[model samples]
Target: MKKIVIVLVLIGLSVISAISLLKTGEVRPTRVSELKSQFLEKATARVDHSKFPILQIKAASPRDLTAACLSCHNKTAQEVMQSNHWNWERPEYIAGRGIVYLGKKNVLNNFCIGVDGNEGTCARCHIGFGMRSARTFSYTDSTNIDCLVCHDNTETYAKAPEKGGAPEPVLDLNYIAGRVGSPKRSNCGVCHFYGGGGNNVKHGDLEEALFEPTRDIDIHMAVDGVNLSCIDCHTTERHVISGKMYSLSSMNRNRSHCESCHGEAPHADNILNKHMLKVACQTCHIPIYAKAHATKTHWDWSTAGRLRDGKPYEINDADGNHIYLSTKGSFQWGKNLKPDYIWFNGTAGHYLLGDVIADTSRPILLNTLNGSYHDPDAKIVPVKTHNARQPYDPAHRMLIKAKLYAEEKGQGALWVDFDWHKAAEKGMQALGLPFSGEIAFIRTQMHWRINHMVSGKDQAVACTECHTRADGRLANLTDFYLPGRDRNLLVETAGISLLWISLAGVLLHGSIRIAASRRNSKRG
Candidate 1:
């Protein structure tokens, strides 16, 4: 009898081990298991979609998913109430309903009351906790940006199924939803890129630029060893998501970098700034480009000139615009005349601002000596040169070495070069733009823009719109702003392809399981 009991115990242990392996797909990593044990000693992984599911309530109704969430998080509710994210919607009396307005454009709110609020188009970003209804009801008057809104990844919640019950529950509810976590990309991208909506006077296209791979530009979030969430940089407070400002680090400012952290002044740090401590860092350390208007700080090229890409851009304006050209492979610029009017060819060879101009143009160049070039009356020379270089002129596009200086007087320039086609190729690679298709045009345009911005045209656009900023501003035009056929469709297609590929693999694996189960049963 004792021998029989031992055999039964061994068989039970084998079954347990087999179950764990099948469920997790690999023998759990020792470190991960240990961490999990320490954090959630009494927890289990919840697999059910219904128990802790997204409670989709209605938008017009008062008892909403948000209200339910606030029932437990009163302090967080206060924070949400004061946040600008909660006030994203506006009452559309013309339509006799409410509409979600992002940044300023109202027409772009696809998640309208007409769509019943719960539509995937609207619900993806505006969803409340425990939202489950076909039509979700949101508190229109209450502008509270709940903490749980974006951190709702109930899919990965792990807890002890028998003892701790349904994984921690989004709050402490009796639901068995999946565990969710803070966004590494998508959550922030939703608002950062204006829900990937129309190309209006918004901000840079963070949606497409956050994921691609390249080092064509620099921004605070794009710098290496400077990992921070959107909230960390954009928020007025830790939990607040208001007072939105363009992340200049992505543009070209190095003042907000890691090396500058804890220093008296970012641009004045002894180790980082190299010693021009008196000058306000942004005076010289400024953003090069981006689409969509933010402050009078961006380069406004909307009414400028036309490019090979069929869009209007500013011409190479005189003095205000620094005309960059390759002189002995250096990013050299014209001499600084009083009210120095420079017009850099947008198609000039790629180079850095600091490397080309060994001497900084000082003696206070502009009457409006503020850093940004976008001021309408910005007192700089206007660009009127059109298609300065013929489209596809191989000779006009060449590789040039350039250096960027931290301080005009003290710092030595950092050397870099520009290769138009190669830069475009590198940008495309970083952006994960399509390799074989009609996107070649977008790639071309994006390359030109990046070249223009880095060329330091007084009136420039952002490289991030086409290039991803995650890895040092990798300009990949093919991925973000394709040449023709509506760039939006290209982005959607890419996303769909990724989704379908993932789903297909999951389905195929499930099918194999069913077939194996059937075969084993028959053999038994």
Candidate 2:
């Protein structure tokens, strides 16, 4: 009984030791308050804009308020004028196309076509004033700048979409100007959140939910986590934003990267740390995009003009996202979408304006992410692959510019009359480019880089997600070989044959040893 008690005690002690070992190995989650204290402890602003006498006056127009601001900040407007935000033009040398000037004004996107003819509707996101109806607006005019759009702390200032990017008449300019301060999530989100047409349209990662995101939604922007603002990562120099658009910009000029804040070696594990050389920070950090809202993934222009009683028709998906629209055509939106992985360096190869179509049968690549495994600068990154079927001219062997939104109904507006030929002709005429007079729908795809709405480290994709699956996320990437995921027939057969032979040899040796032991026992 005493011996039994001793054995029982030993077993109990072993179980306790095992439990303690597990407890020690487990990592505890950081508290919200602790994380906030660590990352969001910023110094209070020194200069209050409300105290200034210039902001006290009742401003009649947005330009008037800008002029008042210029009285104190003399070079602010000039500095803004030099930025791509104001001019909407950035010149870059693309592969196969040399030194092409690209921007929102020049690039033909799947969404809303182009901004050439629809400046009034599209310029709502522009930072300047008097962009309505004028094909050539004055960029040098200092008064045309809208400072309240970025500086308004009151959140009362908002640009009217129909009013040519002007501040709403109901807005108290004096109150907004008095409360003028540095831009916040709300200030930037007013335009960016509602890009394309509505919320989560153009950029899959950017949405209104990022205004006050939770830790699970976006670790950096989380109210409980780092709570980083847009300006924190997109560090501006002389009013020019640092970040680069994959399709718009040729190279990352400002160099906003994960290493900017987090050092080169962020992960504690050696294996994960080594992945940083070939894998982008966002690839692992942001497992999925459009967490809060559904993002448009597909747009088919061929299905437009499905009307009832000579009027536009509309249809909605189960989640209430617009699946079909008479004005915009068909759309497919999804939430919590897995990103398309690609090898990308800083540079992008774009199909510039007037560039000839390479393959008429296959989907035209509007802009391709230029990179490979061999390229030292390249890394495997996550991107939102947006597919579309848009109008193209077979005769010209180029994409057709369709006038989507026009003031008059019969003036070659696809939205108004559902006439592709008239719209194509009008759009081509406006741009002074010759149209083939034959409009055909062609498949096209655009790769939009996913940089925002980052999830917590714990939510990152597991190794088995890609390393084990045959049709994994990285399966399409043929540039490099991945172990366990990729295989050669000879190597696989050799490995299997070696494993079987070793097992058979061990069994045979064990049988012989057992027979020898029996024989020795008989002799004894």
Candidate 3:
């Protein structure tokens, strides 16, 4: 009886420990308040320039970042040491701090399945050679995001730095004027823009041409007079892994931070407004059309049903992971049927026409199904759903398939389906420049402008009134627009036609004059 009681107690203790560990998993215990409080305590301490020379970074190598700065600056080093920035270009996860949060299971690290042949996405952000270097005959340690990599004013900073001498750090009043605080773009931009051999280069362009002193326009690092620095937004906080100025941490991780600036949300979502609350504010209230503004994690699988091959496509748990479709079936795609979908139905998964796929490569296709159908609102849906299962469609079957493969299989191919930049490129192909995805940008802003003028006559012109989703996200447009109201889609049609006609008239006049001159010459 005594032995049985002891065994039961041990079993209970084991279960409790396991449960506690599972809950905590990868969530580090360092609270936002704690990080903030510690930053404040250290930020108060003045930098003793005499002890830590400003010129010390001039000779430092990329690998000498921690050693050069951390030795003298313990608190600041500790603060930055735990940051994703510090661990940016390195392949190994820094212990105690600076861990990458790529789901509980890091698919980037090959689902943490031991870094051997492929060092995962470590080199993309790390300072060493990742897989390519590892495979080479002359391989060393992974490249670290060293301080000198960006700050050293010796080696030329090129897109590709094949020539290995350190580039010169071009200092202007904007960067070295001490006008801006620490952690501004000038500092962060150095590593963020150029570090890890330019891995995290997204959203904004950082090319030298974009920032030529002569040019009046530069979108990414643009200022009215001078360039911006890293410290401008980074402020004093460290361990900053979150995206943009709107991140919870950027607003100081406090609810008051949001309310104080914006006041109460004009369209605050609550339990009463279930649909509105579920959707993020950015979906509707986007201020700008910045490409890298925000990203949706889950793919829009609402159109997954359209991928059906007409046959009874069986859902297989072949790998014990659920992915609605698999390639191990008899009726393999591309091998036999030449799908009619336009954009994403090709053999290589590229936008090409008439390519034959004689083998199975379980490519994902998008819904290229096109036909004007009335939505739930009884309004005509303007969206072009080109059936990917068909051929020559603009829908992305390969991308969807890639995303699914990543989800089901612990690892996947090195290619990602669609980034916003890639999406912009696609939009550019469809709609010419100066109008590439910029239409979506303009349309989004137009909605906001209309919403802001809600009190006035524009209240009736809100997006929900005319262009609404099937869901209750949109208000009924019937009362607002009087039965059939779609005047906006044809808004610029007349103006465009008039512009083309005017150009043609001018060309005709020129042609007549040239023809008459030729006839007169023959007569003379």
- Top lDDT prediction, candidate number: 2
Top-down lDDT ranking? 2, 1, 3
Off by over 4 Å in 3: 1-66, 86-145, 148-181, 186-236, 244-279, 285-524
| Winner of 1 and 3 under lDDT | 1
lDDT per residue as tens, model 3, 160-192: 122121222342211221122234333344444
Q: What lDDT is reached at residue 23 by model 3?
A: 72
Once superposed on the true structure, which residue ranges of model 2 sit more than 4 Å away at CA? 1-39, 133-135, 501-524
Q: What lDDT score goes with residue 95 in model 2?
A: 69
Clashes (backbone N, CA, C under 3 Å), per candidate, total: 68, 0, 53
> On a 0 to 100 scale, what is the lDDT of residue 487 in model 3?
40
**Model 3 reaches what TM-score against the true structure?**
0.32
Which of the predicted structures, 1 or 2, would earn the higher lDDT when compared with the native?
Answer: 2
Report, for every candidate in turn, its global Cα lDDT versus the true structure: 0.30, 0.84, 0.28
Across 342-386, the per-residue lDDT of candidate 1 in tens digits comes to 221111121111111222222111111122223222211222111
Instruction: Tell me how candidate 2 scores on lDDT.
Output: 0.84
- Whose TM-score is higher: candidate 1's or candidate 3's? 3
Off by over 4 Å in 1: 1-68, 89-149, 153-178, 195-201, 212-226, 235-238, 246-262, 266-524
Error of 2 at 367 (Å): 1.0
